[model samples]
Target chain A: MSAAAVLAVVVGAAAAKGELTGDPKAGEAIYARCFACHALAYNRTGPKHCGLLGRRAGSVAGFEYSAAMKRANWVWNRQTLDRFLADPLKAVPGTTMGYAGVKDRQERADLIAYIEQAGRSEVCRAR
Target chain B: MSSRIQSPDASLSLASDAPNLETRRSFLGKSGLVLSGAAVALLAGRDVLAKGNRPAGSDVNVLNSALGAELEAIAAYQVGAESGLLQKPVLNLAVTFQGHHKEHADVLTKTIIKLGGQPVSAKEKYTFPVETLKTQSDVLRFAAMLEKGAVSAYLGAVPVFENRDLAKAAASILGDEAMHWAILRNALGDAPVPAAFMS
Candidate 1:
C-alpha cells in the first residue's frame, strides 16, 4: 500500500475509536504536535489555551496577536473549533497555525477534549 | 535519487508487521525521512521505560512533547543513514546530527522523570511522504525541513518550561537544531540563514 494509504488507515482507525466526545488522553498525545506553538496556561508563539473554551479567538493577553487572529470574529467552541482545526489555513487565511491541521476528526476530537481539560486544570486556574 | 536505499531499523522492530515495515520504511527511505530504530521501538507500541518521578506543573507535558519531536528527529536521521542515499561525508554529518537528537531525547526523558511526569512511550506512526525523493537533494531537502521544524518547535519549548533550567536546555538544543538546519540548507546550495527572525 501507499504511505498516504497507511496514514489514512492508521489515522482513521484512531479517529473511529474516539466515537463522539473523543479521548482526552489520546488527544493530549496529539496535542504534542501543537507544543511547538501553544502551551496550556501561557502563550507561546500562539495564544495560551487556559481559558480557551469560551475565549474569543486570538484574544489572549500579552501574546502578540497575529493580525488574522486578532481580526477573527469567531469564538472557540466545539463546532467552530472543529471547522478551524479541520483546516486552519482555509478556516482563517493568514493564520500562522502552520502545520496542516489534524486531518483526522477523531484526533481533533481527542485533542479538543484534552485542551478543554487542561484549560480547566489547576495550572490554568493558577495562571 | 537512491530509491534503492534500505531502512536501518527493520531489525530493531518488536512488532510483527514485516510487510508494513517494508512499505513504510520504503516510503520514508525514498522520501528522505529515512527513519528507523527508535521509531520502531515506540511506534510499535512497546514500552521504553520512562520511570516515575514527582511530577511538577505543565512542564512535564511540554517536555514529553518536546521529547516526542526529538524521537522523530532521531528516526529521520537514522532513516537517512540506512538509506544509503547519503555519501560518506554527508552520512557522517547526518550521524553527528542524529547523535545530537539522541542527546536531546536523553535529557528530555530524564528531565520528564525528574518533573514527576511520565515520558511519552508509544507513538503512532508518522505520515512520511512517498516516492517524492528521486535524488540525494530530495533527501537533503526533506531532512532540512525536519531540522527546521525542530528549530521552531524548540523555540516554543524553551519558554513553556516552568523550571528555568529546562528552558535553558531547550534553548541550547534549539541552537543546535538551527545549526543543523543551516548546514543542510548550505548543502542544498541555499542560504544557510534564510531569515532575519525565525518567527
Candidate 2:
C-alpha cells in the first residue's frame, strides 16, 4: 500500500475510536432534561444532585430518601450511572426514580459527561 | 398573433339532460378556474403569503407555551424571594427554582427560534396565586402547584413533539420538573412520590 493510503487508514481508525467526543455544549442542552428533577445545588428538592459523579446514591444531605435507595449501595460513577440510566428499575429495583431510562447511548454518555463536569464545580460541591 | 379560439359552451346543452348536473359541472369548472387564479395570485405574492402563514406546528406551539409557563414561574419565584415570608432556606430554594426557570425559559426560547417561531419575551408583571399566600407554608403550597403543573405540561407535551431531539429535550425538562415536584412535596411534608403522581 502507498504511504498516504496507510496514513489515511490509521487516521480513520482513530476517528472511529474518538466518535464519542461528548460536546459539553450539546451535553448542557441535554442536561436541561435532567434539571426537572435534580438540582445542581443542595437544598429542598429531592436530593441535591451536586457532586453526584463519585458520590454514592442517596447520600446527599438534608434530603429524606426512600429506604430502598439508601440501601442500594451503588456509587454514581460513569459506568454505574450509564447502567442505571439505561434501566433504572433493573439497575436498582424498588428505587423511586420513575424515569424510563434513556435508551440512546449517545444521550446517556452526554448526560453523564455533563453531570461529571457540573459535579466538579465549586457550586456543586458547596452543599 | 394566432386567432383566438372560442371553447365550446358544453354547459348549454348539458343543462337540458339533468338540471343539477349542469349546475354541479359549471360550479366545479368555475371553482377550478378561481382556484387556479388564486394559485397564480399567491405565486405572484409568494413572499407576503409566506410571511403571513407561518407553519403552525404543534411542537413550536408547545415550546412557546412552555416558555410562557417558565416566565410565570420565574416571576413567581422573584416575588417569593422579595416577599420576606420565607426563611433563609426557603428563600434559597426559591432562588434555585428561579434559576431553573430561567434555564427552562432560555431553552424553550431557543427551541421556538429554531423552529422558526418568534419567542415571547418574559414579562416583569405576573399574576400569581400568591395573593392568598400569607405565610411560608402558603408559599410552599403555591410552589408545589407550579412545579406540579410544569411536570404535567412537560410530560404531556413529550409525546406530541415529533422531533426526537425535541422530545428528548422535553423529557429532560420533565425529569427535572418531576424532581422539583418531589422536593416541593417533601417541603410540604407529603410523600416524595405521591400516589396520584405515580399513577
Candidate 3:
C-alpha cells in the first residue's frame, strides 16, 4: 500500500481506539527535525517544551518571544499542537521560529507524542 | 511618484477596521499609569519584574513601534484586498490575514497600556506602493515582502528587551509573522519554508 494509505489506516485505527495513537519511539525519530531549535531542558532557538502541553504562548522564562506570540491567548493542547505542527506560520502569523513545521499528520502526531513523553520524564521534570 | 513614495499622509482610510478612539484613550491612560508606578518603584529601589527590567518608560516605545508595524501591515492588506486583483479565494485569505494583523495591533495596544505607555495611534495616512500593485502577482508579491519585513522587525526587537517576559512576547509575534511570510511565499509558488534556518 502507499504511504498515504498506511497513514490513513493507522490514523483510523488510532481514532477507533479513542486515544492518540502515536508511538513515542517513532516520535523520537521524528523529533530530530525539531531537535535543532528545541530541547527538552532549556530554551534554545525556540523555547523548551519540557512542560509545554498546557503552557500559554510566550510564557517560557528567559525566551525572547515576538510581539505576536507574547500577546497570543493560545494554550498548548493536542488540537492546538496539531494545528501548529501542521503549519507553524498559519497557526501563529508573527512567530519567529524558523521551522516551517511538520507537514505530515502522522509525523506531527508522533512528534507531539514524543514531546509529551519526554517532557514528563524524570530528566525534564528535574529541570 | 516620489511624492507618493515619501508621503506618510496618503489616504489609506481603514478607520472602520482600526481600533476606536475611546479604546486608544483607555490604553494610553492605563499604560501611562503603569509607567508611573514603575518609575516610582525604581525610585524606591525595588525591581519591577513585570516591566521586564527595562527602564521605566522604555517598554512603551518598543510596544508603540510594534503597534506601528502592525498598523502598516493592516494598511497593506487593506489595499491588497480592495485592489480587485485577487480572485475570490485569494481575497478571502487576504481579509483573514488582515484580521490577524488587527488582532496583533489590538494586543500590542493593550500590552503597551498595561506596561504604562500609550499605544501609538494609526497614521493619518500611509505611503503604500500603490503603483506597483497593478496585478494579482504584484499584489501577492508586495504582501509577501511586507510579511518578510515584519518578521525581521520582530526578530530584531525581541532580543533588545531586558525583560525575559517581553522577549518571549516578541518571539511569539515573530513566529506569527514568519508564518505569514511562509504562507505568502507559498501563494507565490515559492517553498513554504525555504530553509532550515529562517534567518
Give one digit per residue, the lDDT tens place, for model 3 in B150-199: 66556656554545556566677678778887988888899988777643
lDDT of 3 by residue, A14-119 (tens): 6986546777899986665453245567554468788999989899987768777887789997778988877665577656553345667777788888889998
Q: Write the per-residue lDDT of candidate 1 for residues B1-199, one digit (tens) a residue.
A: 1122232342323223346545765787799763333333232122223433233445565666677667766666666666668785676677767766776777677666655567764233432332665577887887887777677666755554545555666677778888998999999999999888762
I-RMSD for candidate 1: 10.4
Top candidate, metric TM-score:
1
Model 3 regions more than 4 Å off: A1-127, B2-55
DockQ score of the complex predicted as candidate 1: 0.04
Worst 10 residues of 3 chain B by lDDT: B1-10
Clashes of each: 8, 8, 37
Off by over 4 Å in 2: A1-127, B1-56, B196-199
Candidate 1 CA-lDDT value: 0.65
Q: Candidate 2 residues A33-117, lDDT tens each?
A: 4443455663222355677878889887655565777999988886788788776655776554434566677777777778778
DockQ (Cα-based) for each candidate: 0.04, 0.02, 0.02
Chain B TM-score in each of the candidates: 0.70, 0.69, 0.73
